[model samples]
Target: MSSDDPLAAALAAAGLGGVQPGDTRPPEPRIEVVSDDPAEPTGPRELWPEGIGTGVGSLPGTDPREASALVTGETPEFPAFPELPARGVGADMIGRTAGLLVDLAVEVVPTGWRVTARTGRDLRRARDLLAGDLDAFDDACDRIRPHWVKIQVAGPWTLAASVELASGHRVLTDRGAVREFAASLGEGLRAHVAEVAERTGATVVVQLDEPGLPAVIAGSLSTASGYGTVRAVRAPDAQDLLRDLISGIAAPVVVHCCADRPPIRLLAGAGAAAVAIDATRPAFTGTTAEPRALDAIGETWDEGVPLLLGLLPGTAPEREPAIGDLARAGYDLADRLGFDRRRLARLAVPTPACGLAGATPDWARRALTLSRELGKAFADPDE
Candidate 1:
């Protein structure tokens, strides 16, 4: 590969050089290194320690209990840990979180549920931290940044699921509101991506975090006042809206669903560069789960769409396969599924099935380190 055309190299390696909307490409075949920008200043401090709450920025204006009830089949309270300080310094959360995130960016693994932005302020803090992140990523593009660094934003569905309109209606119910909010989100996302590029100068893979896509499609989201389920919107409109929302960003986009019922066909058809599923979540990789997801995965891979398969279990260390074993296991599965192992080497990024905020800091760090090591082992198996 030449120095000037990494994108071409990535697309060619991933079997996506000529594929189109209808053609499924083969499994992934490119490896990415993350950028390293360490000079940015530290952001605000966190009030709470890690591993204690529902995570930062759970949803801006909704009742957590209601949202959880719909998804978990259980009653819910506001999952935010209000007791924890939402702000201060010496907070290692972002740094520690980044270490875990970059480890699994391009390599396939189960990774979703962002804790980096635990509160509204955390997002602003992230902007501050990005200076360092970008600087670090740009300075050592070859050493730290992944060939495809995955950057996430709250998805429209989840945004609709979590955010509330001023009139107390679910955002999804109001097409206008959803469009406006998504547009705003796109602006923030572009800035985030630009910062990443400024720091790393490599391809930045933007992943939209949507846990409520299934519910939104099924018309299950309730209004902010808890009146009733929001009306379902047409698929074409949703896809078009999302496409516009994602416009202006140069990097390939991936829609990530940690929840069951990811709108695979919709996302695929929506022109998303890829669909990232939380393999650790039964909603996706369950033994008795629907075959459509697998078929979709295969189809997407064949169409040159990369799948960020999250194979690591979601719980603590006790529940997941060892990092070494997990990498080998995924490679084997990819081969059996007709994907070339080399493609798997590039397409797969090893990660925990979901977010690690629920795990101890020690566990989170370990998971990240293990992911990097696994990538190394897979990349140079002959060694």
Candidate 2:
């Protein structure tokens, strides 16, 4: 690679040129090692020390204050920086994350968000909206001083797949651009995490949402012209990028994919503490769940990677939902995989099956309330 190579220059320009984020180790199980001096504690670290259930980032409302109040009120122990995509424009997943990028900028086009030469109105709006959300969430936290808070961001593959290049190709199509954005995101997130941590005085957890990853791995995404499909991203390559991103994060990172056939094993190997998925999806429940998918999930759990199981629907169902009914799939997974039900509390968290941005306001509130109930149920049946 020449020093003047455009790819190299772009990466260097993004502050990622010669930087290795942290000591990123390959995902492995918690193993006890025999040592003479003070033996290191070999017990698995508790993933959730406080109250458990939380939403998958979004809700139904356009007002950040109302949404934050609802979120922190119901799921105070594990409240997320509520995402109000219903507010439109720069508030959607991709656009909102653009606000968190350090050096890159994006503008919304007819096709969707695209790379831009400089910071534009769309980018500024994203930043402003996100800033407003932070303020709203901060105020909400002031009342209930939770010990930990969660914040979501788009994972690199999902971000790349969603945003397009100036040439109209997806950013994931260009390796250099993918790394550049990933680096810029990491730098931006470091600052973002520090600020949130400082403001709330709580351990801030990061959730990396990867809704586009399954399609990227399968090469199923259509080109802008719809005449072709993007080339499948190899698993190792995906894991490498994810590892770097996860390692750089000072806070615990949860990689979430509510899609069918999420690459569970792949995500498990990428150094994430947990893999969040739609527990209620056909891919995860009953006879419909495929053998390979079951195996992938089983393997992930065996490696001590906790599963953030989305047990209830993001949108409310017709019938009244019950605690036992909401927890059936979780119990079944354990039975199918030969895990003790008692261990589910330590290994799983209850969340909505997906983002609740499309849910009715009533359902959104109900859903999170149920999540809290489900969390308590998972933790102790005798409670």
Candidate 3:
């Protein structure tokens, strides 16, 4: 590798201090939280304007300029950081997140992303792609300055579950490694949030996307060999690491799990300012939903944690549903759970059911528009 290749040189230092592969050193001190107090979602309603709408990140195309413009124009009230996974490797959720780690780096392998001895081309590309996306986002918001902008990152469990350690096993399989990664992630995210806030002139609210959490909790994810299953991560350990990360973020944090049965109770208890869910998911549908799920939702609302309700489709449907039809899920849940429907207006934000990277350009735009409309309707249903 040439020293003139600035990106690779910078990333090599991160992965292993530019030492030849297979060297080792202690990670920087574990980042500590200001307060050890119970992390009680320090901000939800306070950070979010009631009923505002946003996206779940990721659009179909590779053009960050186009994707950022769409999000900024359609949901100007609350724009989302655009992610274009179609750009490949470094552009995907996990790869983009790996770019933010302080002293940790991951290289794409034939199997998947794996920890490496030195920074590889894949790690540099990941950082480069994400930097380009952020540049595009910054340019899009050059004119209109929204007070709040939402950015997504892979949560600890998801990150641990996705990346392979040097031993060829998942990171979560090693408790010590998991702690180090979590602490490094907290440090990296805080720095990222600060940079975004400075460039965008808006308060950055982080959404930790945990689509892999359910699998981790259920011990359903396959091992590297595909023969055995990883032991289920205990609820308390997940919550504690999450709480520690959240407390250190300083910015308002939202935990998003679009899985069919997101561990709502554990997330709410972990001190997120808001909990984002796919309202259209089956586990959240009427009576078919486990009673505990409904109870958890009710309890979350009662506790005043905002819900980023994903009421619209990630991909466009053959028949476009009415706003009322799309919103029925939230209404029915509240009604069945015995809460005033009006509370949703004050405590919910509308979004697409998931990332729109798979959606066509038309559906992606339409979904953002629908989300904005639902926000208005949720805030003022009579209209």
Candidate 4:
């Protein structure tokens, strides 16, 4: 039946309709909490590498070695591969992900990177920068043999939205291109994770950055000409592509979206081992939390999935809050959701509310330090 059909509309309103034949909607996810009982065979507990806190990637610097060393020193238990977008062009999100496209090449344009017919200078530079960063990361690991390390990349939807096709439209505008890009990214990420593991002797966790996802899903992205909005991708299509990408990576996947209304259920359904969100974001604060956001959080926790709660500000505040003050909101949220405060320690990890690239170097360091303290607060709020 058509979406306009009265019955179809009614069914959709009831949350039981709108699915047509050959629909790609994934099976409704089962939301059972994995037993917290120690005797039960539980999944890995190091979702954020247990008891540690880390950055949201992108430090403020041009030196990969220095950036990596700082991250290793600060978040030794869960250090993330630092990204330096200040290096320009090839170092930004789209350029970085484009470097991982196997067989496909992209070149920088005034608007952004656009697909090219063959490998070229732009593509080579992007790949080289990534290689250099990895080497720097390896060197940092040599000094500090961390047990687990995280690497971030743009998620499929965000990548598709950021990179343009040869025709200049976004890759998200073409279903075929979206699938191909997802496959290539998956292949590349597997290789990337394997290499990190080999060099660091650490378990690798992959975080997919999807900051642009809410815009992509809401059809808020501008057209190539800036005259109209690009068509919004359906949630099922987005979830299927993400699931495919996640399945190909051999490491735990964390979907990080700083959007006010991240698609928490969609990310969880796509098999994300965890979802990262900015809990301190203004939208989630105040008298009434956004019902949908609250529901998503509750549902995500109900499924035994951990949340990387972005608790600390990316930049230093005029007056820094105490660890308890920084962590109070999350504790309050848990209570409001009817969860025991202890669950915060078991299923939550503290992080800076977002990336720190925009912050001064001093604030970046301070923010990371506070994040570690917040993790401790979660573990022992009374201390």
Candidate 5:
């Protein structure tokens, strides 16, 4: 690879370059290691609010107003526009993204929501629910004036994986349908971001959730027939579609996937300002069989991109982890990656390991408090 290649630069910085036989001397440090794209932002902290804590979207219950209040009050510095999936079909990820489609509609079916030839009551309900959530978000923000607010939607691949074509096949199975959906999603998100900014008086950051992406790329999505899997999507094609969708949006973008082996490099290559992953998962903690995942982490951080590390448990645990315990895990990661521990504060944002929608109300509140404290510990461990 050329010296200017971002992957090469990251590999060199992390001292992961290939070595020849009989080479005993230590590798020399490369001073110019950096992102291949000069246009890439300095770091995620630049786009993120000064506060270090945020949520992973979904919260428990059906009331948007209550969810918004809790999120803003707990994570005042970097509050996320709460997603309440517990509200049912239209309020889930696919239903929410379908609501954002410019000229398309979806209806609930026995299998799930499917693309419809025309608009219907199902689509209307999705839009209405989303609007109610936005209203609640605006009301909550008006009192606190958060510096930045985050909103998440299903990314193209996950959307395609979820919705079925009229023919009963997944939209991802048809190349043309995939492209059309991406265009519609991009158009709708641009308007959504603008409206949130207008209403909340805060800079908007968009997060593209793709929990189903690994399955999509791995050809593991069950065929509509329930006996087979869809064909795997090539890495380049997936990256290109994501890049196109992200480029069209006028906000800092974060790609989040809680998959055990999220395609970290592919997401970074697709123009994400930050990649969110469940850092507490075994794959990232060096206990899993996959070593490359850890290397991807090192390379990502070395390229000056920020990581939204999911350090807090999403559900209630027997007992919550202490601030020092969470801080130690971060410091350990830095040491393993050969980076300075101080970089954790500048390059990481603490979040729940995943969404807290399944937790009891009491555990949910405790999780957010712990997440906020973890962020504070990252900034000032001694305190």
Candidate 6:
């Protein structure tokens, strides 16, 4: 269903937005919230981590040290959340998460802020949890009172890659299961978008999390249960599945990946309004391949996809990498890609490569502050 609104049509046609250059759009910071922190307590009492736009439950049994390792790639002291609670907390999850985002938006967006919430991983059983989750999310927004809101759910490919089959194998290997899962997820998302928009009176922005997407397409994720390592799923074919997911929402869609090698073209073709990525790690190798990254960046830029570049590190200050250091490391990639600093500026939205749930409270706050500062530096017309 094509939108009659020019902005919607333009965004849908191009599939993204380019960097706003020298154009002094005063920084209207919308607090974009992440899902799940494995290190914090999970009780209902709302606790907003410093610098985060909203509240989220801390993961159980995850040490601050171990969580830091997951984000920074250091030796692990503890394990990450193997599984999060997903059986019956649908409405509650929606409200808690939305309330959390609203909490953050109130602090960040001065003129007005967009509030959003993320539905946790356990989407395979979406059919069971969908309606309740949507209802709870809508109710939560009524309490928080936000202007714009986002709803996030795990994407199909990632879900297919991650979810276990009844046989204890991966669902990705079963085309039928994949299809069913995609349809269910799409249905849930459609209902979710409507509830969020109507209940919160917010412009709904649905972001699908696909951290495992690049690996899934690259055939990097193999079956640990001996289902013969999963094979690469083609993007053109996958686009149909993705299109269904995108089509369900009447609002703009953002496809976010923690992986370096995102399927940018497929996402662009699938009608994504933006492509959010973690650029903390290099996607391509040495200086020789910088051009490819630049070209990829340019293609997405030309297609109107804004690159949400992950810039902040989630670990402690000791573990965190400097932005200038990261920028220099990305210099060849940026230069080779043929993106002028200005173009890069327009295209980039710097952030931590992933969520800071693993970091200590101090680290999370610092990460947010650093991300904003780095974004300012990157956005400056002079630099």
- TM-score (all chains, Cα) for each model: 0.61, 0.88, 0.87, 0.87, 0.87, 0.60
Task: Give, for candidate 4, the lowest lDDT window spanning 10 residues.
Answer: 42-51
Once fitted onto the true fold, the runs of candidate 6 whose alpha carbons sit more than 4 angstroms away are: 1-147, 284-289, 319-336, 343-345
lDDT of 1 by residue, 1-383 (tens): 35467766676777667554466766767898877967789653211111111112121112323222221111011121111012222012222122222211111112212322233343444434444434433443434333334555667767655544444455577787666667666766676677766655445667676677778777877655566778887778778877886666676777777676677777877777767666655544436545676676677767666655665444455555565666666665566468867666455555455554454545544554455555555555454
Q: How many residue pairs clash in each candidate?
A: 44, 0, 0, 0, 0, 19
lDDT of 4 by residue, 272-354 (tens): 98999998876677665787788889999999898899987887689878877878887888887899877787678888888
Worst 10 residues of 2 by lDDT: 19-28
Model 2 backbone overlap count: 0
Residue range with the least summed lDDT across 10 consecutive positions in model 5? 42-51
Q: Output the lDDT of residue 199, model 6.
A: 64
Q: Candidate 3 on 1-383: residue-level lDDT in tens?
A: 57787765876767754655465677778887698687777442467677778999989998999988999999998999999999899998999999999898789888789988788899899988988888999999887888889999999999999999988899989999999999999999999999999999999999999999989989998888999999999889899999999999989899999998888889989999989999887667865777877788889988888789888888889899898886776677778889777877777888999999999999999999999988887876656
Candidate 3, position 45, lDDT: 41
What range of 10 consecutive residues in model 6 has the weakest lDDT sum?
74-83
List lDDT for all candidates, in order.
Answer: 0.52, 0.88, 0.88, 0.87, 0.88, 0.54
In model 3, where is the ten-residue run with the lowest total lDDT? Answer: 15-24
lDDT (tens digit, per residue) of candidate 2 on 1-383: 47887877876787567544452445556899777788667886546652379888999889999999999999988898899898889999999888999878899999999999999999999999999999999999999998888999999999999999999999989999999999999999999999999998788989999999999999999988899999999999999999999899898899999998888988989999899999887877877888888898888889988988898788878986888877777778888999887778777888998899999999999999998888888777545
Query: lDDT score of model 2?
Result: 0.88
Model 5: CA > 4 A from native? 1-45, 49-51
- Which candidate model has the greater lDDT, 4 or 6? 4
Off by over 4 Å in 3: 1-45
Model 1 weakest 10-residue run by lDDT: 75-84
lDDT of 5 by residue, 1-383 (tens): 67797876776776766533355666576798778766956433457643388998999999999999999988888899988889997899889889999998789999898989898988999999999999999999999999899999999999999999988999999999999999999999999999999999999999999999999889999998999999999999999999999899889899999998999999988999899999988888856636788889889988877888998888888987778988888878888889877668867888998889898878777778877888887787546
